[model samples]
Target: MGGIDNQKKFVLDWMDNHAKELSDWHQVIWHFAEPAFREYKSSAWYVEKLRAEGFEVEAGSGGMPTAFMAMWRNGAGPTVATYVEYDAVPGNCQAATTRQEPRKGLSKYAPGHTDPHSALGMSALGGALAVKAAMERFGIAGTLKIFGEPAEKVRASKPIHAAKGYYDDLDAAVSFHPAYMLPMVNTTIWDTHCGVGYNYIYTFTCDAPQDWIASDKYSPIPQNHLAARAPGANDALIHFYTLNESLRRSMLPFTGLWSFNEAILTAGQATADNLTPQISQIDYMLRTDSIEQAEIISNVMDNNAEAAAKATFCKWKKTWVAKSRPGLANHAMAQATYDNLILVGAPRWDETAISVAQEIQRNLGLAPMEKPFLPATERLTSPQECERLMRKQMPEWQRYLTSDDYPDYTWHCPTVRLIVARPMLSAPQGYTYPDWVANALGGIPATIDPMIQSAGKTIGATLLDLFTRVDVLEAAKVEFEERTGGGVGGSKWMAPLLPKDFKVPHQYRWPEYVTTARGEEWTIPYRDDE
Candidate 1:
């Protein structure tokens, strides 16, 4: 193989050469703005691109139609994998301008990138392609795996993939996210990592509408009378919703950081008939520091669903959408990743980028600072310091502050979570810009390109090192084994929380864009004339 330095140089140069291509890819994804599990167009584009780049692409893997695994190997060595997330959040639809305007001809409730998975996915793509180019040019022996993960906004896909043994063979993996409240210019998560998170959909169906009136078959009213039928699925959904809220406070200790939030996935379908409403769904998501805690919460929620179903004369079925373990720490991988991050440096913003941010501030009626970007964007932060700062705000008993599914990858193989800066306007002292301002900046090329390029280079360099430098990969493995007791089957290691045959919940009635008689529109339906 060529010298390590030469390989690194080649990868960086390749990334620079393909900068525009990466930017264009990011733009396309940003424009698509597809939401969880429903990212059909976004996943198709990635699969097509990966295939064109010579990777053996699986358009859908792990039973998820929008999830894929793309592999490119050269003579086999350590397998290094990176993942991409393309799901956007609903109600974040905003144009790429400084003003808070939704996309043209789309409603404000349409999905848009809040965390901006567009940059995140593009960075992973750029890194993988750059590393592939270097591996071929330098005769580097290894395999590269790229995963297209969908529904990340709800912490979906990764757990399902890991449970089905999709991530078992990897020597190491890398994950990335755009900087939000935290200013992670060039840093990896230190400690205080994410905890266990669970997602479930309780589907209440009134399929046996006749059963409701079975006990009163001899009532004075005729059997076909609407009054004889029970209050249907809508009542069951309301009871479940109210009962779950009432039971939330009893699910976990208030001392630690834990939460339970619910969303009504489907209420009764639009109907004017007096007939009983047939179907309804409610989704519940919870985050806790340990799997035990998550289980306790789940049991309580299940019980509530049963009671609600009985009272409302409906039958309910629960589907596990996501179950993620707490993050595992790897010092060796973190140090190696941090070293590469320092080499790549922080994202550099020029006049064009700064002007866009300043314009956003001005539109928000706040005076633009001389430096429109966050100071952290121009500096490097150690993971240790980042963790220290993060922990300071967190309560003493809270081991994990937030929830993310990436931790699932850590148990199977050593994984590094990389955080790179994305541009955010530096508001005037003691003032805050509305969320749309940040969302707007994420779609603009000038403001977000620095982050995309810097992250791509950092990821590419780190992946290249693991491919060529056997010692670095071995060191990461040693740390992984020690932490995981003996390794994959170690005593301390935790198995996937999901069952192997667990069905993927992509078929659920999730919110998505739809075509209506008025024209194409969001599922919630917004009229342009309104």
Candidate 2:
């Protein structure tokens, strides 16, 4: 840690040296803005760069066409795996200002870096290059792995990378993201990858008289066609407002639907219209810090989707999607890491001290008070009695209302909230956009630039330094043994064993489905009861 100045200088210098290249990479990626497995251009771009860098590059290794793995080795030593995400939020083309309006509606879909995942790829590239340079300059013996992961907005698909045995041989993994401030560590834990569960998207096509509807005689046939386009349509905001009201009344008990709802609404207002309204297809994953809560929330989700679909007369489709291993849980283990960061040198650590430091951070325009890694049961309880109990039992929640990252106060997080205003231009008479796509469009940059770079750099460097100090490489050995009940041999790595405790992950096939050539028999593969 004594070399804090030097290390900071090195990282900054590295970023500066690579700025042109990184920005080029960023711009290229920003321009393409591919989504998930469909990231052909983005993937090819990275693969070309990685190949030129003399790393062993493998394309289509993870049962995914868009995903790839690249590795470089200096000597026989511990393996460290890093990840890069290149998928763009679908259908969000815009001018590069911090604004929420599309310059003009796109004819063909033009993926935008609204999510700034391009920044993700750049960070991974930058960090990996820096570490490789460090290892070489210092003559350190270790293996450096950089994995190209896809589709984070929904599935998070990292578990798929795990299943591909991507992390199977790694000593440890590191990821840096763009955000508003340096969080010592992110507390929104619980990375639960789920199987593609099905819900009945019962489309009650209004079979009214021709004059009854404003549009043409729309049939269920064309419905599926425009469904995926829902994320890019003008009705997206209405969808957000409507869903918010719907969930406000009928949201299930102890479910993080509220969080999901808030995230969606924020996305809609800040991003695009297609994002919220024409949610013809719902692809959602449930995550929380507690496994018990995760399970309860999952059950609630299944029940709620089923109930909603049945009520709507939608047919059920069961699509087997794989959920990632639970998100990085922030229980005792993670908390210990936070506490350890304090034991080292953070500006402040304790609640009171941290609170004051948080104010300073806010003054600096950094997002304050990282979202708490709370359990679903506690956070999702919408009962009036629970609200009353909170006032009496956890007045701290009340105290922090002025500025707290409580689970219930998710929307209050300025970073998470998206402010909506009428677009400068009038909507074209026939103009439409995807709801979810648009929601993501407007707000994604806030997560990356100046925000994520500042936050991620500070936190990532601190974490890496701590790991180096505490001998995290060795600790991971013990952690693997204790958590997996396995020995600390080379097998003591990151992949989850199947049947016993893990299983092959489900694949995501979105916006595409199989059907008869005549279009008579429909096969909506992404449906709830497929």
Candidate 3:
């Protein structure tokens, strides 16, 4: 039933003819490596190329200056939406495939294609063009909407658009990501815009004694530095720390503390100095996937502000404040689109694929996978711990803020999946920005060998075929319950796969564990005993 319909045959043929051009376009996009919401040249190039394909393109939409939407069709059949993303992760800017040193040309951050959003644009374009050719050949009438979303690295733009009702009318949507497998269907759910941050500010003012004393007997005499307000100094320091502690306690486990020390660097027309001995202002963010959770987080942040203000300035405790973006709730509709794509011939790698990835890491002298499944508990603590969870070289904590609270139970859900049709010639170094670009370009460790990569793709494609089968989703909905000893339905798959009691390679750890040795990206072999 998943076989190419006469319409699909035409689409596939069109894809085969343009595969080389599409690959070249994707590679160039990878090399350009721009950051989110600021993709100038890359976005322009895509627009130009897309225009050549006969799409009526809108350059900016959704309140984002860089966003775009392109469409082609007779406006007759089911409206299907597809998306293309070309932004790179921030920091570690580079264009080399082999392990390269961090670009030292700048004092601060450099952009990198870690996530490889370049491939997303190419893949979507490829698919859309194929669809266009099919429509023209078979004279089939249908609508295809391709949206170029921006700032996925900074905020949950997609969901914001969805909340604005951008995707309400579509009959179905599809997307394909480059992974180790040619195609595989996943019964598991996927989530987008999973985190957020909130900022808070506070200020304090101290009053001085009013009576003037020049000299003796009510004279307006100035006192020595040590004699004036000495007690106030002691009071201020103790009060500040106490307030800080209260703030810490109030913070949600998933939320992170934005270092007040650093935030001051951005103070408008002002700088931290000796005169401002009294603590003046503060900022913070609360991150979670649930609106209810966010509300709870807000309560905690606000309560902390109030408590701290009261303890310090007494009646002046009124100097408390709060501001924040709501955490990005997972999109069931997008997850359904991802699942359906896999079911309809998208590639994916399974647990074994993760093992192979671990092996690849070891060959590069990288750390081995510690456990097969992601830990059920988030174990989130401090900014440092959350950074470790993301594993990217330049982690944007301000971008994805969530509580350390891991899901209470393991759902069969798959966070993200990829099919690698090609073997990576090298491994990316630790926390490298733009790692997703590498991941998108069949990013796998070189140590795993080309044969494994090829084999993985074979498995992935097979899985995709299964997903593409017309009735597989329905069939799996029933079968998964009996086999896994779990409840049935799409929502049931939301549970995470837990680390406990799960068997997996010791080396397949998250991105944070790997490091660069000498000049090459490598990790120590997994040592369970350690």
Candidate 4:
């Protein structure tokens, strides 16, 4: 094989040549701004593009209509995979401007890229394509897979794919996200990685209204009179919401951090006439450091759901949306990626980019600095140091603080989680800017392109190194086997937390755009005025 340095240069040069196309791709996805499970157009665009580039594309993998897998193989060797997410948040819709403005002809609350998975996904695409170019040119032997993961806002898809054996046989995996909260320009999460999380949608249906009323034989009312039925699904929903809150308070106190959050899906059908509401759904997600804690929380939630159903005279069922495992750290992989990051360097803010950020700050009525981003964005922090800083704010025993489904990929194979900087407006030293400012910056090309390009180059270089340098791949695999007992089938390894037959919750009433007489509209209809 040729020297690793030559392969790295080939990949970097490929990225440089395709930079404009990558930027355009990022723009299209940012404008698409489709939300979870509803990324139909976005998915189709990716499938077409990947196929055109000679990838063996599988659309609608894992029973998710919008999820896909793209693969390119040359000869035979280690299989390295990287995944992308295209889902946007529900209520963060903002246009690409310095001020807070919704997209033309869309609801102010329509979906937008908050973490801006647009850049996240496009960068991964650029990296994969660049690596593909390198492999073909240099005769590097390996298989590269790019998985299209949808519904990541709800931490969905990855767990399902893993359970269904899509992630099996992977030598290593790379995951990337737009950095927020953590200020580091480029770093992989060290310890205190994301914890186990469970998401479920509990549905209550009042199908048989007659069962709620007393028997006619024992009733004193006239024969022609209509008997009053129970309060129906609305009452069931209220009962569940209240009881869930109470149960949350009753959970055992521990030094580790945990959280239980709920979002109501179905309250009641719109109606003028007096009739019992039929269906109500409440979605609950819990994150904890261990499976034991998640199970405890899950059991209590189930009990509360049953009691609520019994009391309100409704039938209840649950749909498991996501069950994710805590991340397993690979210091070997972290060091390897960090080395590539140092070589690639953090994103350099050109004059135009700096001007755009300063303008954003000026619009926010805050004094703009010469440097619009936090100082941390221009520097690098070791993974160990990042973890130390993160833990300082948490209890000593809190091994898992936040939650993401990427951790599930770690259990199956060595996965490196890379975070790259996305620009944030510079405010006065001790001041804060509004979220819309950051959201607005995410959509602006002048501000976000650097992140996209830098991440693409770094990831592309890392992929090339992994494929061409056998020692680097072996180092990552050795760490993986050590942590996972004996690799995938090891004694200490945990099987997928989900059952093989676990039904995908695609039928749930997730937010999506709709078509009406007025043309396409968000689920929460947009108003031209006010």
Any runs in candidate 2 off by more than 4 Å, and if so which? Answer: 1-12, 98-111, 180-282, 288-315, 328-472, 475-530
- Structure candidate 1, residue pairs in collision: none
Give residue 14's lDDT in candidate 3 (0 to 100).
59
Residue range with the least summed lDDT across 10 consecutive positions in model 4:
218-227
Error of 2 at 109 (Å): 8.0
How would you encode candidate 4's per-residue C-alpha lDDT over 433-523 as one tens digit per residue?
7777777878888888888888888788778878888888999999999998999989778788887776779888888888889778887
Which of the two, 3 or 4, has more TM-score? 4
Rank by lDDT (best first): 1, 4, 2, 3
Question: For model 1, where is the 10-residue window of minimal lDDT?
Answer: 217-226
The per-model lDDT (C-alpha) reads: 0.86, 0.42, 0.41, 0.84
lDDT of 4 at 152: 81
RMSD (CA, angstroms), candidate 2: 14.0
Q: Give lDDT tens digits, candidate 1, residues 1-530.
A: 23447779888888889988888889999999998999989999999999999999887899999999999989969899999999998888999998989998888888999889989999999998999998898898999999999997677799999999999999999988888667345689877778998999999988877667654545544335435667789999999888887777655456367888877888886875666788999888888888877888789889988999999889999988999989999988888998888888899899998888878777777877789887888788899888888877877777776888999999999999899988866666688778898888889999888898889998999899899888889999999999999999899999998999989888888889887687778876554456
- TM-score of every candidate relative to the true structure: 0.94, 0.54, 0.51, 0.95
> What TM-score does structure 4 among the candidates reach?
0.95
Q: In model 2, what is the error at residue 307, expressed in angstroms? A: 7.4
Give per-residue CA lDDT, model 3, range 180-235, as digits (tens).
Answer: 21112122223222233323333333333222123344434434332232222223
